[model samples]
Target: MLHLLTPDEIFPSLPEVDLERLQRRGVRGLVLDLDNTLVAYGGREAAEPVLVWLREARAAGMRLCILSNGRPRRVRLTAERLGLPWVESYTKPRRRGFRAAARLLGTRPHETAVLGDQIFTDVLGGHRAGFVTVLVNPVSRRELPHTRVVRAIERLVFALLLRRGRIDREAWRLRTS
Candidate 1:
């Protein structure tokens, strides 16, 4: 049960993800979380570095899809700017949305990776769907009130996981390259 919340990999930020390493590990597709993942909370567009990372992934022949819980118009606009397909208002932590994103990417769960900032949502849903899960630090300190509450719980769990050695420090290092 606790393992479901554990991410397969962790990166300081989205741009820090090593595309080459993911490719070597058989991740041919990516299902991305929008808010505080690709874009900062309440931001209109992805930063230049994020854009570059997406471009690099595309150039490497990786399929990408945005699965956002945000409003339809916001999600659609962001997806359009990113030039990626999207599943809007996709309540995360649900297997349905994750699987839908996988189908949209035309990739099997094993071939897909999900990247996001929240453990309870993105990591849990990705694990439930049998896709590789990557967690990144939230791009902004600002977030919704409900999310702030969840973030507190996330911190506790993360510490416990670290103390118990459930997190693989070596795998964390492996991603740096």
Candidate 2:
């Protein structure tokens, strides 16, 4: 169960992810979390750096899809602004949405990567759906009240994982090899 919530890799931010490395590892598509991952919660647009990184990933022949639990209108508009397709209003920590996003990208589970800031949602769902998962630190501390509560639990789980050497706090890449 803990492994289901464990991210395959960790990066400080979306822009820090190595697109080339992911491509070499056969990651053909990216299932991205919009809020807190690409942009701050409630922000209208992703920062310029994130936009540039996304463009670079697309240029590298990697497909991208926004998979978010946010409202449909907000998710749709954000996707449009980023000029990407999106899967919105679907609950996370569920395999259905992750599979849908993978299908949307025309990639099999092994060929897709899910990137988000939350472990319980993105990491767990991606793992359940059999896709590689990458976790990034949240862009901002500002978040929904319920999310704040979840964050507390997330911290506890992370601590346990860290202590057990299942996760490395100092290492940006969590690969065992």
**TM-score to native of every candidate shown:** 0.93, 0.94
Per-residue lDDT of model 1, residues 3-26, tens digit only: 998788888899999888888889
* Cα error of candidate 1 at position 125, Å: 0.5
Q: How many clashes show up in model 2?
A: 0
Off by over 4 Å in 1: 168-177
What TM-score number comes out for model 2? Answer: 0.94
User: By TM-score, who's the top model here?
Assistant: 2
Judge candidate 2 at residue 89 and give its lDDT: 46
Deviating ranges (above 4 Å) for candidate 2: 172-177
For candidate 1, the TM-score is 0.93
**Residue 29 in candidate 1 has what lDDT?**
95
Error of 2 at 15 (Å): 0.4
| C-alpha lDDT of candidate 1 relative to the true structure | 0.88
